[model samples]
Target: MADIDLQIACEAPALPDAAFVERCCSAALDKIGRDGALAVRICEPDEIRQLNRDFRNKDKSTNVLSFPFELPEHIPDELKLELSELGDIVICAAVVADEARAQQKNLNAHWAHMLVHGCLHLCGYDHIDDNEAEQMEALEVQILADLNFANPYETL
Candidate 1:
């Protein structure tokens, strides 16, 4: 099994403890069969909104934003073994809480879903198309199920 180095920075009171976030991230990485280093930042609405607007051109707060690392193609083989930095996940505590409440879903489950979603993004999974969305969602559902959580897409 590969090792995952996860760093969690919480800027909101609603965010869970570092240990819980680390577990969620580790589970995601394990499901994807990857070992990497990543950072999860739990921030407030304003922080998320600014990031969304700047990076995605959306002037609103989102539940999460993923910044995947792209390595150069010409890197030496030996260098690749020492490089494990995957990317960063920025999650908005308030937005996640609100969405979970509005969707009538469990808070912890929803948070796990977000973490899994972000980690998948780091692994180059995207939902820009229907087919891609289906594939990604299936992986997410399977991962969540393995973690004893319900399918995130299923209505409550």
Candidate 2:
């Protein structure tokens, strides 16, 4: 099972519950054929904006950010056996909610998309170019579909 440490740092009452978050994240991890431990932090816009500015060099708040963990090469192999650390996924609750409404998407489906997107990032998936985007987006759509969610990229 994928180990997820969920941290809800926002005051939004509409945020998804722990079980739903785990199910979404786990589905992504399983689809990507990755097994590990990760953290999911749900925070407010201000916090996400600060993170985006500091790490991504963007001043705006994004819906999600993924920080993949890298173990030092010097660490002994035996030590690595115990913990399969993936990384952290920071999602802005306000941004997610707004985007769901703006996109006319089911809130739960949107949330699943964000979590799956982050999990893919944690597994070294990115869309820096057209080809890469195609690959990643295809995987995302398939994973979401497996979870019974509609294609997130569907036009409204």
Candidate 3:
């Protein structure tokens, strides 16, 4: 088994319950495997907007933003590990709620989708193009199904 470091921070008032957060983190780590460390931060809209602007150059608040670490081909001995440290996943609870409503999905399902989506991003999945989108969406469906959630791409 790999080392899993799951951190959940509620930097916003609209954050979900502790139990829900714990479940989300556990589900995410399970899907990502036990090897890597993941940090999930639940933030307010403004906080996410700032990060979106700073990192992605987008001024709007996004549901999730993944900052992946590009490791070199060869790392120092001290940096070598069985599992890698996946970068941070910042999620905006407010944005999530808005999206859930807009997409006509239950809160739990939407949150699950975002958590899985963020974890996939940490694992180097991207959807900048149509082909990538198809692959990523397929993976998302499979993972979410394994977690017993509905297909995230399914329309209501």
Best by TM-score: 2
Error of 1 at 45 (Å): 1.0
lDDT (0 to 1) per candidate: 0.84, 0.94, 0.75
Runs in model 3 lying further than 4 Å from the true structure: 1-34, 71-74
Q: Write the per-residue lDDT of candidate 2 for residues 76-109, one digit (tens) a residue.
A: 9999888699999999999999999998999999
Q: Taking the tens digit of each residue's C-alpha lDDT, what string does model 3 give over 1-156?
A: 223344445554445565654565556556656336666778778888999999888989899998876668787767766446777778888889898888899888888888778877887788999999999898788777877889988776
Sort all candidates by lDDT, best to worst: 2, 1, 3
Worst 10 residues of 2 by lDDT: 25-34
User: What RMSD value applies to candidate 3?
Assistant: 3.1
Return the lDDT, model 3, position 25.
51
Q: Please, what is the TM-score per model? A: 0.89, 0.96, 0.80
Candidate 1 vs candidate 3: the TM-score winner is 1
TM-score between candidate 1 and the true structure:
0.89
lDDT of 1 by residue, 1-156 (tens): 323444444454556666677777788788888878887888778888999999999999999999998789999989988899898898888889999999999899999999889989998999999999999999999988988999989875
